[model samples]
Structures are given as structure tokens and as C-alpha cells.
Target: MSTSTAAAPVVADERVASKGPVAKLLGRPEIGALVGAIALFVFFAVVAPVFLQPSSIATVLYGASTIGIMAVGVSLLMIGGEFDLSTGVAVISSALTASLFSWYFSTNMWVGVVLALAVSLAIGFVNGWILIKTKLPSFIVTLATFLMLTGLNLGLTRLIGGSVSSPSTSTMDGFASAKAVFASSVNLAGVDVNITVFIWIALVAVASWILLRTRVGNWIFAVGGDANAARAVGVPVVRTKIGLFMGVGFCGWILGMHNLFAFATVQSGEGIGNEFLYIIAAVIGGCLLTGGYGSAVGGAIGAFIFGMANKGIVYAEWNPDWFKFFLGLMLLLATIVNLVVKKRAEAK
Candidate 1:
């Protein structure tokens, strides 16, 4: 007798589920920051009418760009699971290097600029190398670098320049050209917007692309998530970390050039605590302290929020003294919101 066996039923995999658009959007690390930015913008617009003015908007953008430039690198470094406490002083050091070298040697400003770039990259390499070799926490490694650089910035400037600041480089060869590239401004709809703003935008765009679309980006996430696992999977953990630190140095070099060209002098004492601002911006942008998550866009939004709060207080005619309190509150609230959003997304 011929008997036909019943066919087995097809079963869909329970582990895979199709996510809708809303779920996908919420899944982004920057989503909470985006919401916060919108709220902040509205609050400022309502409280300070002048904040909406074109000139005021330009000022806000200028302020944002300054921090945002460094935030680009700082955010990336955070995502790669590391910190660079030396960044603040490193910037001033770069500017000082360019200024002192050019003025002392009576050479072209370009020469000093190139030399400063080398010095900055070397500093990054040293920091990374030490971290890799010693397996010390990046915090300690960079903190040591920070202290050393702070001392060097002051001691060297005093010894070489005979003062706490470098000599004026406005008349040096290539000074004008460099200034035009780094410190010039553009007129947009009757408002002057600093060149650094455009540069910051370019940096954000490039960094976002690198983080989202390249093999290097994959390696970054992999290492940040778990260095040992990443190494086991053939990722270049050492190179990636070193490259990230170098990226921070590159950013420092750019900002340093801007400062020197913009003012024609470098103050050894400047940029002492600005590293915290960069780190705060990255954190507010949704980068976890533990790392392995965050986006360039989120950092940009964080910087924008900072600009608003900084300028908004003045526009509202409030006491500037309260700005710090406001900042701290924002930081705490942002962190909580980010954590909540992350958990909710994961649940989805």
C-alpha cells in the first residue's frame, strides 16, 4: 500500500523581526540628543528673542564651531573607548610651537605650521604607544601627558619668547595666507560666519562617513566593544587606537593654527581646561562612558546645545555665574535621557 506522509509545516524564525521606520529611527544613538537639541532651541528662542537674530545666530555658530571641531575628534576617541586629557593643553602647545619656531628661527610661517603638526602627531603617538605598551588606563596616560605639556607650554614660552606668550606672527611670510584659510569669515545673508564653522561641518561630515561606511569604522566599534574579542577577530586594535589618538592630535593642530592665525599670538596659559568641554560635549551627544557607541551627528548636536546655552544666558540677561549650574544640570539630564532612550530601543 502506498501511503503519503504529511508534509512538515514551514515555521518562520522567531528570532528575526521586521522593524518599522519609527523603531529604526529610535534605534539611532543620536535620537535622544536630537530631541534635546530641538527642545533647547525652542526654549532659547522663546526666552531670548534676540537669539533669533541673524548676527546672534552667527555668533552661536562660531562658538559651536570652536568646540565642535575638537568634539569631532574627541567624540571619535570616546567611541573607540579612550580619553585624551591632554587635548586642551595640546592645542595651545601646537599654537605655541608654530609661533615660537617661526619667530625664533625667522623662518616662513608655513615652516612653523608643519613643525607644529609633527609635534602634535608625535604627542599623540607617544600617548598611544605608552597606553599600548604599559596597558595603563588612557586616563592616567593622557593625564600625565597633560601635566607635562602644560609645564612645557609655560616653561618653553617663557624661556624662548621671554614672556608668557609668543611673538606676533602677523608679518611673517605665509601668515596672511594661513589666516585666510583658518581664521577668515564669510558673509552669509548679511552676517559674517567664521571659516571655522565650515571647517567644523566638513569634519563632522567626514567623520560620520568614516564611522558609518568604512572597514576602519567597523574596527573602531569592534575594538571599543571589546578589544580582546576584536583582536581575536583580526581587528588591528593597536593601530586603531593609535590612529584615533592621532586624529585628536590632527584636530588640535587645526584649532591651534586657527588660534595663531586669528590672533597672531599664543598664550601659554590658554586652553588649560577646555578638554573637559570636549568630553562633556561627547557625553551629552550620547557617547557612553564605557564606549562602543555614538555618532558624529550626536556630538555636533551636543556642541550646538552648548552654544545655545552659552549665548542664550547672555541674551536672556541672566547672571553669567549661573551658566555653570545650567551646564551641569543639562549634563545630568542628558545622560539620564540617553540611558533611558537606549534601554527603550534595545527593548524594541
Candidate 2:
């Protein structure tokens, strides 16, 4: 009896093993982004002699870090079947808010930091709440926020800082510590690596863990796949969306602080149109425009590709105007590749 049972399980395991690793990898959401990134790297490396230089790599990573931070946030939210148009201006809004408060009260930089975080979180909450309450499309809801924040950023900066940009907070109290936390750099192999790189990496790690190892992650996929179906199955769609947006707000705070401390001043007019880059990076990372299929690491890889192409064009001495053309072409190509990959993955 025991021997018969052992062989039964063994045969089942052997049969499952026949699927092969290639098929398994192809099924993963990140596969397309990974392949595209590799291809792009090779293309640039061949055409741009200096693309392989140490400092050049650092520049690419730095650019990725800046966009990657937000990419992580939007990726998570996108995986939950939503978009946040306000994200771009929200970044500038937070920076302006922090700088204005810090300058106004002559308080510790942390004071402004804390207040700015609160404000950002509130903005996220409002965006989510309004969407849920109105039953409108997220695109419409967040577009309104984008417009509102764009105005408030400019208006508030002028009202408080008396200029289109916030006053410098470089010499404010607690500036040094804040700088260390948000804007400091470390020497890595004789190359200066911004602290944002570490932060972005950590975020990707945590997000991947959340999406893969936690119950919340399951809910995210389910909700994005179908909110009504997820809710019927007892998933809290509202909280999940609200939390996702709040997560975006949290990243906004981090990036905003970095902007403030890195430059010591905040430009209210900055960050407009940057949201498109974040969305594009996330899309390129394997997150579907329709939602419910993506990964945090994919988002990072997508940003890496963006960063590489950004600097690679300069290194290749190509016209900057052609960058968008490359992006559009890549987007179309990647989508087609991913569609085939997903179909293959689900075929079994």
C-alpha cells in the first residue's frame, strides 16, 4: 500500500515538471519588460560607445531612481485598477507646502515635513473618496485633482513665498539631517549614488513582497481584475483603493522632501507632465492599462529602460526630440509582445 501511494505522487510530480522553465518565465508579467530592457541595452551599447562608462551608468540609474520612486507607487495603484493624474502636480504641491511652512514658521524642517505628509495623505484620501462616492471613472476624478493641484501649487507658492517658487529652506533648522535622509549621496565604486536609489530599491522590494507574500496582494489583483467580483468575494474594494492612493501620497512625500532638500527651494510650476512619464514607465514595466497584471520589479526595470534611453540618446549624440518617438514605438512593441506572452502563459 505505501509503495503504491509513493509512486502515485512521484508520477504526478514528474508530469508537472514537464512544463519547463521557459514556459514558466514567459507566464510572468515582468518577462516582456525584462526582454525589452535587455534589447534596448544592447542597442544603445552598440550605438553609443560611452554608454558603458561607469559615470554614464550612474547617470542612468540616478534618472531611474527619480522616476522609479514614483513608478513604484503608480504601479501598485495601477495593479489595483486605477490611475492618478494628480500625481505629477501632487509632487510639486508637497514640496511647495513643505518649503512654505518651513520658511514661514522658522520651524524645524521636520515640522514642515510632517505637515506636508499629512497634507499629501489627505489629498490622496480625497481623490479616492470622491471617486468611490461619485462612481466616476478614476481618470476623470484624478484629472480634476491634477487641475486643482496645478493651480494650488502655483497659487500657494506665490501667496506664501511671494514668488512662483518657494523660498529657500537650505539654511533652515534641521536641514542637514533632512538632507542626509532624503538627498545625500554615497560613493559606490567611485561613482556617486544618490540615496534615492536605495530608497527606490527598498520600495520595490517591499512592494514585491506585499504583492507576492501577503493577503493584501491577493486582494489587489482580485480587485483590479474585477472590482465587483472582488467585492462579492468579500474583498474591501474601497479600502484597498484608498490605501493604494495613500501609498502614492506617501511616496509623494518622500520625493517632495528630496526635491526640497536637494535644491533647497521648490518650484511650484515643476512636475507638470512628469505624471505621463511615471505612467509610461509603469506600463512599460508590464502593468496593463486594463489593470490586474504587473509587478513592482517590472516597474523598476521599466524605469531603468527609460533612464537608459534618456541618457543613451545623449551619449549616442542623437537628437533629443526623437526620445518620445522611441518611447511610443517601444510601447506598441512591448504591448504586442506581452499580449502573446500572457496568452501563452494562460494556455495551459
Candidate 3:
């Protein structure tokens, strides 16, 4: 009887397997990003001679690590049907907060790190709370938080250091643990890769597993697909959204830590403009701007593309100023392609 029951299930699975390649591909959103990344690699490899170099590849991956870290979190939050504009500003805010604590109080580096994360989480809670409580769009709520955090980051930095850029000496004197975590790099294939690479990779792996293998992942998709409908079905929509917000905030805090490790001095304005880049990378990697359809790995791949373009252009001796033009073109092309692909998917 058990064998017969198992045989019946196998027959049902065989029926689904016969649905065709398009069905299988549609069932897995990650395939789109993978295909896109491969295509881009082929394009660059064929046309840009420098792109194939080991050094060039290392540069791309290294640059991608920082933004990719945040992209993973934003992708998860986007999948849950929300956005956080304050991400970039929060980076600076956290860094400066950490700097202030370690520099002035002579506190333990880990304590300052904890305090920075807590501050970021508090901001995230406020963002989610205001949105849920007031029935406002998350975009509006987060935009306000973004602007406020930007101001706070600059204002606080100046108040502390009397300038926008905090000096390096202050950081070195105070944060020993921060230095060990953020500044260390591992040598790989003659390339000095930051330790943050492992962190980003780990985050992507964990996020992908959670999304594909866990019950919480199911709830994330359901919430993003339709919050009201999900709530009606007993999904904890509010709690889910709040969790996503906290995830974003935590990502921002990690970014600050990574940046501090990379550059000992904290710059108030360094990360303020990165908000759009994270969104663009996520969108290009297969996350829908409209929400509910994207993978964490896609976001990482998107960051890889950005990093490749940035470093490849410079390595190939192209003008750095052209980066802005390239970014605009990329944004336009990716959006158009995504729309076309989305239409075809919907039509089918």
C-alpha cells in the first residue's frame, strides 16, 4: 500500500515535469538573472579585451561585494512588497555613530558596533511603524527617513569632527575590534580581496536558502503578492513587512562597517547617493520594481554587473566621467528588457 501511494505521487510529479522548458524556467525566477549575467559576461568578454583578465575579474567582484550586500537585503524586502530609500543614508549614519562612540568614550569596538546596529534597527522600526500606522506608502515613509538620515549624518559628522570627513586617527585610536573585522583581507589568486566578500557570499547563500527552502520564504512571497489577500489568509503581513524593514536597516549597518574597514575615515557624503544604485542592481538582477518577483542571487549578479562596468571602464582606459552615461543607458535597457520579458510571462 505504501509503495502504491508513492507510485501515485511519482506519476503526479511526472505529469508536472512534462509541462515544458518555459514552464520550468518560469517556475524559477533565478534562471533569468543567471542567463542575463552569462549573456553580459559573453558580451563584455568578446568586446572588451581587458574584461577577461584575472585582475579585472577580481576588481569587479571586490567592488560588487559592498553594494551586493545591501542589494541582497533590498531584494528580500522588495520580494516582501516594500522599499527602503534610507539605506544609503543609514550607512553613513551608522558609521558616524560607531565612530563617535569608539572615539569619544573609548568604548569596546564591539559595543560600538552593536550600538550602530541598534540605531539602524530603530530607524527601520520607525519607518515600518509609521507606514503601517498611517496607511501610507512605504516609499513616502522611507523617503522621509532617507532625507532625515542624510541630514543627520552630515550634521552629526560636522558636530563631532567640525568637518564632513572624520579623520582616520580618531578611528584607529578607538576601534580596535572594528579594524580587525572591517580592514582585513584575504589573498586570493594574487588579488587582495576584502573579508566582506565572504560576508556577502554568505548572505546570498542564506537568503537563497531561506527563500527557496523555508516556510518563512513562502510567507514572504505571499505577503508581497498581495498584502490584503495574504492577511485574509492569516499571514502576518505587518510583522513580515516590519521584519523586512529591519533587514534593510541591518544591511545598511553592515555596509557602514564594511566601508569603515575599507577606509578608516568616515565620510558623511560617501554613501548618500548609493540608494538608487541598490534599487537599480536589484531591478536588473530580476527583482520587479513593482515587487513580488525577484531572487537574492539576482541582486548579487546585478551588483556584479555594476562593479564590472565600473572597474572595466577604468581598467580599459575609458573616461570615468562616462560612468554616469553608462549607468543611465544600463538602467534604461534593463527596464525595457524586464518589461518585455514580464509581458511575455504574463501573456503565457
Task: Give the top-scoring candidate (lDDT).
Answer: 1
| Candidate of highest TM-score | 2
Q: Which ten residues in a row have the lowest lDDT in candidate 1?
A: 1-10
Q: Model 1, stretches more than 4 Å misplaced? A: 1-18
Per-candidate TM-score against the hidden true structure: 0.95, 0.95, 0.90
Tens digits of per-residue lDDT, candidate 3, 1-348, equal 344446664555433335578766755555455566677678778778888887777778878888899999899988988888888888888888877767667776677788999998888889888989998988899999998888887888888788888656434544555666765778887877777778889989998998889987888888888888989989888888888888888888888887775677788887767988898788878887767788898899888878877886776677889997887777677666666766766666
TM-score of 1: 0.95
Stretches of candidate 2 exceeding 4 Å from the true structure = 1-17
Tens-digit per-residue lDDT, 43-154, candidate 1: 9899999999999989999889889899999999999999899999999999999999999999999999999999999999999999999999999999999999999999
Cα lDDT tens digits, model 2, 1-348, are 344546675555433545678888888898898999999999999999799988898888888988999999999999999999999899988888888998998999999999999999998899999989998999999999999999999988898878998888888899999999999998998999889999999999999999999999999888889999999989999999998999888888889989999999888899999888889888888898878989999899889988988889999999999999998888788778888888888987
Q: Candidate 2, TM-score vs. the true structure?
A: 0.95
Query: Per lDDT, what order, best first?
Result: 1, 2, 3
Tell me which of candidates 1 and 3 scores higher on lDDT: 1
Q: List the residue pairs that clash in candidate 1.
A: none
Distance from true position, residue 199, model 1, in Å?
0.5
